[model samples]
Target: MLIKPVQDMLLHNADHYLIPADIVAVVQADNNLYHAFLVLTKIKYSKIPVLDNDGHFEGLISLPLITEQMLGFDHLNTEILMHMHVSDVMETHVKTVQAVSDVEATLHLMINDPFVPVVDADGIFQGIITRREFMKSFNFLTHEIGKQYDMIEKDFSSSEKTN
Candidate 1:
């Protein structure tokens, strides 16, 4: 199928796909690893956004990072790492997308992340667009296309009978 129509649909309905920041759980860079870990565990999120003191987006902290850091300490008690700051373990180089970004671009960005953080032009953290949300939209589109195709087939059959 042609991509233009899908692109148009995404562009027109872009706002519906966004998850606003208020609902997203974020961790502060200065927060201790224990606090960040608690947030991740309580939310059941594999990764969470890291925000600086000014509430600007900093990076992402994931379980893998915590695990990697814990592994480095060897015999040191895991609790020791908890006292460390999330800034020490969180990935600083993060990828973010503007709220106005097209679905195609967002999808591409999501290939490397569970969710892509949305930001305003001024770099203010907004919400995130999760892969789950994108799949839901895709499924709806395909279902609608199937219904349209069925209608066309029915119309074609009725015309043939009249002829």
Candidate 2:
């Protein structure tokens, strides 16, 4: 459940390097959602990042958002794209998980969060935790340490049952 071990796992993965940093970039407030979409189109297979003016974690400008907007665009004039700012559409009340947070907490955060923004203690943006990363981490955790998941899951279920 430690972050150091999880970070090490991330680093140890052979395909981790293939995962580009820009795959989880934070977008600035000045950036338009349209521009964001354009950037996404350029890196369609990668994760999207959204950041604040000070390079803090804002929220994710995800593929789902783009797909939703694109699908709904038929109802609006095409020019509506040009006037759309990220602030106008981005989730302002973003849920952030600290970089030092334990892996278990991060998993819970990711489970409930629309998109979990990973940040440092100062709230500066680090990277993001996608469902993919969660899955990958889970694979690593369970595979490397058998029965760890069973114990963790049992504890979690007990807590829920008690609550």
Candidate 3:
């Protein structure tokens, strides 16, 4: 089997890198900020996807987004967090990539963005590709390439000695 270098491997599609939607933490658009806050607090992730009742991608919600709504003149207004919908404060202008998006394009985006949401043709959420996961995969592949090079070098040296 042949393995391509990182430069060549990046040309592949992004589907293999996805962390599927079924395992990703998500919030409903209709949920209140308080509810969103609870989930965000529980999960170690910085942000989560917001879905509509029908499982369509809506936006992204984070602690800051939810907390901003709770701010008041003198105190944190519990009312806003408990009453306002998540759709009100969640980030709608999120950067997203399709399952078949180019890995190189996705890599460029991940440089600044922490995670890129994955959506289908109809805007249905599929999964997310996080920077951490990408980095880990990159590291593993590079190491594998190094191993392959070492093996090739050993083979070349042994063959030269036999001549």
Candidate 4:
């Protein structure tokens, strides 16, 4: 079946699906690696958004990025590394989607990232939509469609019997 209608229906209430920024764990660009590491450990999140001091969205940081940098050092300099800023290792090229974006656009952005950061028209950080959430919504829509198909089949069968 065509998914445009489903996409429209889902995107109509897209704001409701967003995980607001307030609830998300975000590290500041100037934050030390030690702090970033601690937050990542505490949250147990693979990746977390980075923000600047002005509360503008910066990029994303992941545990692997930290580990990759750490691996380059023959001698683990915990003290020096601890002072490294998040911006030094954070990925600047990030995929972002607007809060009002359609599901198809959001899904396309999410293909390369675990979660797509949601922003406002003014480029203000709003929240994120994770792959998990998207999958859950898609599954629900498919399940509901299946039920509707079953009902239609039953109705058709009943009409045939009557005729």
Candidate 5:
């Protein structure tokens, strides 16, 4: 049976690969660093998006980002977390993609990030397109292509033997 055309295989929009915003775990920008750390630990995620009170995508916060501030010459200053905010150390200037963006572009961006955050024109947090999701689709596409190639080779071999 035929599958999707090669050009169509990987060109789907970012929304096609989205892990929607509602299901995503997010920490508020104004949340204290300690709370952010707790959330990351509880969720067991390396990083999570940060949102503002208006629900705009601010950036991402991670355990490492939280701990970085505590590193000192003699000991970790864990006390800093209580006084700081997620915005104090969260990574801003993250690369993002639009929902209308092509999967090819999102895949390229994912090479540098575990997930590419999605946003609207107004910077509203839409969701994320994760490398895991992209790879699932990519693996399926390649597997289907390989199957077609094997079938073609088998047909060619049969035709040659008949001659």
Candidate 6:
């Protein structure tokens, strides 16, 4: 019996997360305007949750939002710094992915919304894996089974030694 490879499906769906770093934006309340600008400059594709040291997904700082805030704040003496905390801005109750889910579920997620948050089962924030990255990684898997074989070999060799 032939098992269908999920990697094929993931690769086909890579376009869902085609967002580039050019579009990604990160912001935290602790970050100054300058720092937020730098983060925007670095990750230009999507808006990432502003994370606390404890790894909670805080507020998001996208370029468009920052620009609007900048315009609103230009005439005021109030510090833009006051708005830097992500907890004040990030969308709470972010949708997330479970690692054990199949490609069909992931595709449905991406199709419904491209910005699903990827998290561990425990709800810890892992790196956000975009639909594009997921597809790319799966495509890479399509090329060869060498890595899987190597891992299997290593496990067998270790087991033999132990025995």
Q: Which residue pairs of candidate 1 clash? A: none
Model 5 residue pairs with clashes:
none
CA RMSD per model (angstroms): 7.1, 6.1, 7.9, 6.9, 6.9, 13.5
Better of 1 and 3 by lDDT: 3
Q: Candidate 4 on 13-53: residue-level lDDT in tens?
A: 56567899999999999998888888998999989999997
Distance from true location, Cα of 29 in model 2, Å = 1.4
Q: Which regions of candidate 2 fall more than 4 Å away from where they truly are?
A: 1-23, 45-47, 63-76, 112-115, 146-163
TM-score of 2: 0.61
TM-score for each predicted model, relative to the true structure: 0.79, 0.61, 0.78, 0.80, 0.81, 0.53
| Count: clashes, candidate 6 | 16
> Model 4 Cα displacement at 147 (Å)?
5.3
lDDT of 4 at 145: 58
Q: lDDT score, residue 157, model 1? A: 57
Superposed on all Cα atoms, model 1 deviates from the true structure by an RMSD in Å of 7.1
Residue 124, model 4: lDDT of: 77
Clashes of each: 0, 4, 0, 0, 0, 16
Q: Each candidate: what lDDT?
A: 0.78, 0.59, 0.79, 0.78, 0.82, 0.53
TM-score for predicted model 3 compared with the true structure: 0.78
Q: How close is candidate 5 to the true structure, as a TM-score?
A: 0.81
What is the full ranking by TM-score, best candidate first? 5, 4, 1, 3, 2, 6
lDDT of 4 at 118: 85
> Which is better, 3 or 4, measured by lDDT?
3
Estimate, for each residue in 1-163, the C-alpha lDDT of model 6 and write its tens digit. 1134544444444545444322344454566554665676676654665655565455455565555555653473236735564444445655665552445566666775545555556554554546666656666666554544342335555557755
Ranking by lDDT: 5, 3, 4, 1, 2, 6
Name the better of 4 and 6 by lDDT. Answer: 4
lDDT tens readout by residue for model 5, 1-163? 2244653665443346888889999999999998998889999999999999987999999888898888999998989899999998999989888773456567678888999899988999989988888887777777776654444435555557755
